[model samples]
Target: MLAGIKSAFNNNYVSAEDQGARPLIANRTAAKGWETFDVVTNADGTISFLSAANRKYVTADLNDHTKLIARAATIQAWEKFRRIDRGNGKFALQAVANDLFVCADMNLGGVLYANRPAASGWEEFTITALSSPNPGTPDSQPSTGFVVTEQQFNQIFPSRNRFYTYAGLVAATAAYPAFAKTGGHAVERQEAAAFLANIHHETGGLYHIVEANKANYNHYFDYNSKYKVVPGKQYYGRGPLQISWNYNYGAAGEALGLPLLSNPDLVAQDPAVAMKTALWFWNTQTGAGTMTCHQAMVQSKGFGETIRTINGALECNRGGGGAVPNRVEQYKKICAMLGVDPGGHLSC
Candidate 1:
């Protein structure tokens, strides 16, 4: 039965024409995102295979009448797959939605969909373990289980080490999973680039930790007293993402296990805490926008939407070409460096 990790087999079972999430095929060869699948035990004794890239479960399309799609975030009646064992390392994934088995149309190069009721050859698939720490090819196409590597991160930022010490940045790698989770928003390179670009703009290529021009840093404590009651401490802009205000300090502190509310200076002094706060804000906060910055980039909503997500109410397109353009330009440049398509939606 289900014991270890397994990757999707996309050997000629899917059409070459179909790509991305549409064709819904899997493959091996040490890829990160697509090649990895986690088997989960359901309460009803059934199982689910969650894709590492899309972060969704294999679901039978209720709207299209059994059209199989791997885009469900939760396990519902339509999402649970009945794994029927036919022995010899073969199993058929029968969809609970229509009681139909997952059939890979080999004729179409393997466009996965639900159509058959019986466990046949097309529905049968083999499971294996996952092992691909090899940074993935190009780092563009979505892959899982691979860290960007210190060398690559340094090369990307060049002078990043100038602000964040090598030891500190390396230590932050432990927290990389928070942003690059198997089913999280920052899993994709485009999303990663968009995040870095915004943070880079905020911190000037990781050169500064605290805001330099601002004088009334302590004003944050008085103006937003509802967040944290720090009689004299100032929760000003600090860290790579410049986490500011008492509310943000409290939230970031709570999220990263740091007492930012009591000692907001930790964000300015500690590189790991600074980066963590930045990533925390990027991955979770919606601010004035409808989605998180991670969601904006992952969903192809453009870099502009990220701006909106960060400070849309004031600094968005309405900033009169003051700040939003700067972020967009930097994001585009970073995308160019990464060799991944920027994928439109550039402005707020």
Candidate 2:
């Protein structure tokens, strides 16, 4: 069952209205026959939502800016959606046909449309399994399969702010499925330890939300990038990795389908978003180095390579002003906690 996040709709479940076209709307107060959808995970990893209303596949109509309608007779490209887990049982559906998120657009009287470039509050939905005793209630359990357990994470970052939740990090891992799951158990634990250690250094044991240096806040805006800096918005260091610069924000926003270029505050505001941004940089970006932080770990390149990929410009070899040694110590400590060997080449 899919429920809208907008206040105007009052978290109503989506209903495939029975009529000529069977348009999808977020006005149902309860999940019954028409409100339920069978989430089909395709062979290609894409998803197809089969509406229980008419036993038809949900289609994002390409002719109408991808308006969601349960009228497709068979599964096609327009029926495929990428489910982006937004932590806490919420998810955003991105239409494969348009490469846009499906939004419960309030402007259209709660009609669903796959037209949003980014996944904001409007695009988010709570998808509950109907098999549960309480149909609409989300599962209370934290997402599973992550290498780092909540207990282990809490023990690692006991001083972490409430915003940096273990659940949020677990949920963010869904965005990059192969994050700590890539290598074998030992390597996976090493990767998790390395990532947590880096974040610990950046956030000062997860105590800080934003960069502490206020003087450098306004300096992150880039005048020459394609991503125009929005006036009054500061692209300061934010999230676990503290992603900075207008171009980085824009690029991450584009990849994650969030308006980070304009609403950079989302990274600091939403815990799940913050973790997602951090994971985005961890799994993709190779800032100041040759390989991504993820590659540095999974490829057996050592923890030092991870540091180089993250902050080599300042911390690789030029003494790192004590930052490099601190990172190494933290990595070793975390590796010990996880019972994994702190592999060689511990310094960049």
Candidate 3:
């Protein structure tokens, strides 16, 4: 049920895909460090987990498999992903006719699917040998397992590792100009990793539900409440990534090739538009070329600095609503994820 770490083996069964796994389960006789919890691709284009030290595969029965269940519910295109028990005590992944493998799951009616393209980070798994965990009665879409042990899950799943990551401000910024110019300042790899980090924190490893407790803080702000739409007031939040505020909404709409809306509610209804709006805000409004949200943090020592700057310019804070404090908290949390001292450090 759980796992322990073990020493590296002299076995030559290791393949290119079997490399770089952190030991999740601890082994009593094994050393403290060795390659253990590994990720690899299957022939069917789905990801496979490997446990190097124990030489056992992680397989789940169809009833116990959460990932496949979720995929089956949403994407009809996944009718083919079957879980087959390899006779030698392993499982093989296979797809159905006219169906393909998607690397990501859906959130809010949107699914981030991937294909076998090098640019999209797709890799092909080479099966030197055949093995099976379940025999004759394999499900059309069978359950799969991590080749990892319990120790590996404890060690690797808790932190920002390759096992989990997602798109957020970082992805929006890097992929588009609006976010990159203002708040989305991370370079290619950094931005990619950060986006995944933010999404990981938001959705818990990219496959879980967007927790209600963590939703708004990670999502775009204004769309959470629909009853607050005032005639001339700023509608700040909306969408999966939660792009907020009148200025951001308007600007993001233009960048994403959607119609401009001063209201945040519009973002939530159109899922693709919501993503576009987020990208718009991150790329143009928050980076170096424009308002520079991160730079403002360097100057004023917190997110409060950017809020105050926006308030001063927009006159929206005329009522003294106290958005600065909230901004400071969000900014601090993001900084902490990067392992930076929010109060002590001025330069990022």
Among these predicted structures, which one has the highest TM-score?
2
TM-score of each: 0.55, 0.59, 0.31
How does each model score on lDDT? 0.64, 0.80, 0.33
Question: Which of the two candidates, 1 or 3, achieves a greater lDDT against the reference?
Answer: 1
Model 2, C-alpha of 128: deviation from truth (Å)? 41
Lowest lDDT 10-mer window, candidate 2?
A: 1-10
Model 3 scores what on Cα lDDT? 0.33
lDDT of 2 at 339: 42
**Model 1 TM-score on a 0 to 1 scale:** 0.55
- Please, what are the lDDT tens digits per residue for candidate 2 over residues 168-259? 89889999988988877567878998999999999999989999999999799789999998999999999999999999999999999999
Candidate 2 local Cα displacement, residue 276, angstroms: 0.6
Which pairs clash inside model 2? none
lDDT of 1 by residue, 63-121 (tens): 87566666665566876778888787777888777788887766755666778878666
Error of 1 at 177 (Å): 3.0
> What TM-score number comes out for model 2?
0.59
